[model samples]
Target chain A: MNTPEPFLGATSHTPVRHHILSVLVENKAGVLARVAGLFARRGFNIYSLAVAPAETKARFSRITIVVDAESAPLEQIVEQLDKLVNVVAISDIAPKDALERELLLATIKTDVDNRTSLLDVVGNYGAAIVDVDAGSVTLMLAGTPAACDELERELESYTTLELHRTGRVALPRLGKAAVAADPD
Target chain B: MGGLFLYLTKRIIVQLTGAQALIKSLEMEGVEVIFGLPGGAILPVYDPLIDSSVRHVLVRHEQGAGHMAEGYALATGRPGVAMVTSGPGATNIVTPIGNAHMDSTPLVVITGQVSSAAIGTDAFQECDITGITMGITKHNFLVKSAHEIPRAVAAAFHIATTGRPGPVLVDVPKDIAQSMMEWWYPASIEELDLPGYHPVVDLDADRVAQAIELIRVAERPVLYVGGGTLKSHASAQLLAFAERTGMPVVTTLMARGAFPDSHAQHLGMPGMHGMYAAVTAIQKCDLLISLGARFDDRVTGKIPAFAPHAKVIHVDIDKAEFNKVRRADVAIRSNVAAVLEAWDANQASPQNLEVWWKEINAWRETYPLVYDEPAVEGLLRPQHVIESIAKAAAPGTIVTSGVGQHQMWASQFWKFEEPGTWINSGGAGTMGFGVPAAIGAKAGRPDRVVWCIDGDGCFQMTAQELVTARSEGIPIKVAILNNAYLGMVRQWQEMFYDERYSEVYLSPDLPDYVKWAESMGCVGLRATNIEEMHAAIATANTINDVPVVIDFRTDSSEKVFPMVAAGASNDDIMVHPLQREQS
Candidate 1:
């Protein structure tokens, strides 16, 4: 029997990095399920996903999906998503060529002794203390996904009572900056 | 709102309830027939259907209705329509929906839902059909209001018929079906506000040129045709392309009739249970020009080892299919007909395939499809029955089959010379597909004769549909190869599992097929030997007013030879023991 060789197609290789796919879809009932169900059925890994109404009219919802490229091919992901009837457009935003942001809200356990130090750490990351109670303080940060990750790491020193994060959202960078960064 | 105001001012507003609007929409789409059953949730829609131009054939089960719709679509190029009530009715049709999705058949399935207030409350006959069928359908619509009926129907038909055609579903709530609204139908698909749906129709020049360049330089080439060619109605173009290139063309199971079986350049079906020459030619070819054929696991065996020496040029209407399995050296995302038309215009001299044809011819001559006589003195072979039926049927007879050993025998023995003449559950391989599909095909093409080659196990699954045929005045012929066991499973158990047989046996005489046919108002006959089989077939051909069923008692021990075991390389294909011994 002849041993089979590994296929060397575009779908065969596993990417080492994450892919952020911004999809615009019709604002209809079960549209989100259709998009998410496609991913689950096709076995595509979703790291994070956030959806919100795009523009003022709310005719369409923009879905920001961060996919683990190691599980599914990028080309296949786009092609499959494009097949959905509600999906209007899909843009794969590269890390450098796009502006990415995420929002983090954390309630940290703090006392008099560590309150100043926690405030200093929060200040260093440019995070704001939205509310301050006797035992805990609530902080909010809206920044780059990497920045949010760093701030979350710094807050790990203190006890985190509760933490919440809005998944990353992205758009292609405009003007000459995006043009210069084009790998093509 | 502005468009509604303009329509109201420009034309007289005709007030109609949602059910009436739905039926009127089907009429506007020129739907000639619908296969369905009425229930509590769908009764309102049925009331309107009585007065509409669309003829409704009441099916015994929702599964039969779905398969009949699929058969109608497969026989005719038009999208088949099927309607059913909520819950079990919707769930029963999921198998055929998945089958249509896999085979890329154009089907528009409508399922009734509980009233708007009853949805999500687990009311009687309530189920989230749209959610259940999301993965299987090309797209689906859930009409919340009466006003959305016309647009939803229009969109469902458009999505089902265009691009890589597959099943699309519309789930209408019972309350929505009863609510009154002004009737307004969209003039065209463009007016339906579907910006996301666009099927690629034009061929990319660069890819075509690259494929042509490969064809020019390749010493050995094969034209691998698939169901997409038939879907695109490109059989003529494919025939011309094959003749011009002088390449050996191998049609897959779904594509049996896309190219004439009698054509000299044709190499028969390919893959597991495929012809020895056709499978060997693909394995040894240097250039593989795949048209509308996906590299399904059944055809590829072990994917990495399949056509290892070939540089594949894959063409399909669906872009996602390009690199889904085998990578294409040149990928053309367009209709198969468009690509063939483009390639036909850029005419080049045919390549010299003398050495290739000589090798393939030798294989064909050495391992021609052969079966030995049954060990029992008077037992009939299933293959012989299929051959006899094929010989007796008229030139343009349509053949449908249930999945199993019988389906393979029918595909192997029948000589198909035109497109849309062969319909079967190719992708999903759903059993009990033959009877309902044959009925649907006969209903679609009343002028042509339709024959269903079914297995006993498969016949029992949806045999109730024969009643639908009799009551609806559609005449079809069914030849049940009654081996008394699930022959394919028995073969696998014998070959790989130490012949335990397990529960594969279904007693030959339990139901009495002749009595069952008579119960369903069909003429039933029985055959045990070749002479009896011939006589049965001859009697079946003569009955034009009523459907006929013939029970052929065949030897259960026979297996489909020229086999490639599951997950094995194509190089390890096993010929029949008799043929091997002769060679």
Candidate 2:
């Protein structure tokens, strides 16, 4: 009654390495779940993921993913994803060839005496306040991933109430902007 | 063409219920027969099927339908279709789906789902069939709208039969099957253009040149052929390549019939329970040409020690198969047949391997697949039964089996003369696969003789399919080696676990298979001695209108030889070490 084992490659105890994979898939109902299911069932570690309509029309979507290659190799993962019915193409976007960004939002508790100090601190990181409350100031920062990380590291002393960051999204610089990201 | 497309979409006025549309589409797909059962969620589909030209055989168990479909595909090289209801029906077919996936059998399993509103509510017969079968299927779809049926069905067939074949599933909810829509099947081949699944058939000429160079220079080169040879229908090309290169060939168990067994360069199956000559060739070869085969752990014992001196050149359709197990010095990810077609070896360097051939022939003679029948009174061994049956089988016979000692014996003894003639549950090794799968093969090719070599423990698992075979007039022969125990595990206990056999033995003569066969509308025969064994086989061979079952009360002590212990290297193979050989 046992099922056949999914063929897995020999694992090694090497240094952790990150790999960026761009997957183009058809825009179907369970396409996202199917791609995610492969990772869950195979025990591949996913660092981050982002999905948007691909350069095509509603027929396709592009999924950008960050993975820990040390845990599972990118070749096996891409091949497995390629087995999916809706998947269109898989490309590994090298960091040097693509522009990547991350967005972070931080809500800091501020008092009247120290509110000016926090404003100066937030302004230094090129962040703008999105909302204001009685005791908190919510700031949003969108930039290169490193820039957002630098801002988050510097804003730690402001008695931060809460913080959230979109993991990352990337696009190739020279080719063209995506053809199907609908403008609202 | 654009105006016609618009006109056809606008002018279509005939509306049929989803079930009718499904039946029509299946008719258009040229489906002549379907193996399935009806239940709450699938009654709508069944209703229209009764009036359709396609014939439906109602299976007693969903699992039988699945394996039958698998056998059908193997026999005809066409996609096999099975339909079952949701929940338990779907789960029952999971094993067959996995079996097909592992063996690369092309199958389309259509399972019923709960109504769209009741899908997640745990309605009667509700189960997530698509979700459950994601990993096992090449692709799966849960069709929410009746309008999606035409394209989805076409896509399922396309995905199932192309680019490394595997089982695909389409879960149709009850609402969609009963819903009404204007439908017409897709006509053009252009609609099947799958961009992501572009199977690159063009091989790198440099890789082929390198492979040819390696073949020319190597002293000892062996060809390891797997089931994909049969799947790609590349046996002729493979034979040509082997003959041209003069390299000895070893076929894996799944690839038993890929090359003719009688060929001089052909070594028998290799792995645990593999022949001595084949295993030795694999271990000693300087260059191993792996063709359309994944290096399964069963084939490569302990991984690292397997073929230590061999530089592998792996050629397969799937890219991931490269370095999946053994690393390939040169990897060509293309169709094996296509690659072989592109290979032009005009330079003839005749390098003689007379010494190597002599060594292989010597090993074949010294450690042949042989066993001594007992001189003791009335004790018939399983080996004798298999040997007798093997001698009696006609050319181009299709032999199937359940997983156990009997499978290994059949594999060892049966000389398959043609490709696509030997079918078994190789990867999944599901115990009940024999009877149903043989029935499927018989149904697909009524002109050929099909034999299911089964063990007592394995026979009981799906023997009820004998009734189905009788009803369908498949006329498949069942030869049960009645050992009264799970012989493989018992042999393991005797060797590895100090002979403490736990729950491995069945009650002696408990089920009375002779009477069971009779009740199932089969002519039952019993063979207690060598004379009756021959007579029983002769009698079975004569019966053409009805199915036959012959129960041979084989010696329980007989074990399969040339055994490699699980996770043990081939060099540590043991031949009847733990047991005494009777005169």
Task: Report fnat in order of the candidates.
Answer: 0.75, 0.53
Kindly give the stretch of ten consecutive residues in candidate 1 chain B with the minimal lDDT sum: B370-379
TM-score of each: 0.95, 0.92
The sequence of per-residue lDDT tens digits that candidate 1 reaches over residues B412-465 is 889999999999999899999999999989989999999999999999999999
Q: Assign candidate 2 its CAPRI class.
A: acceptable
Predicted complex 1: CAPRI docking category: acceptable
Q: lDDT at B373 for candidate 1?
A: 65
> What is candidate 2's local distance difference test score?
0.83
lDDT of 1 at A56: 41
DockQ of each: 0.41, 0.29
Cα lDDT listed for each candidate: 0.89, 0.83
Residue B409, model 2: Cα distance from true site in angstroms: 1.4
User: In model 2, what lDDT does residue B581 have?
Assistant: 44
In the range B1-583, model 2's lDDT, one tens digit per residue, is 9999888788656798888888888888788778988888888899999799997877789999999999889988998999999999999999999999999999988888999999789888888888888889998888878987877788788888888899989888999999998876777656754566655456778888877777677787788998878888888888887787677899998888888899988988999988888998889888888888899877888788898899988988887788767879988877778777766344422277777788888878767787765434676888888878888988788999999899999998889878878889988889989999998888888889999999989999899988899998889999999988998899899889999999998854789899999999999999988888999999999898888999998887778888888898887776654332421
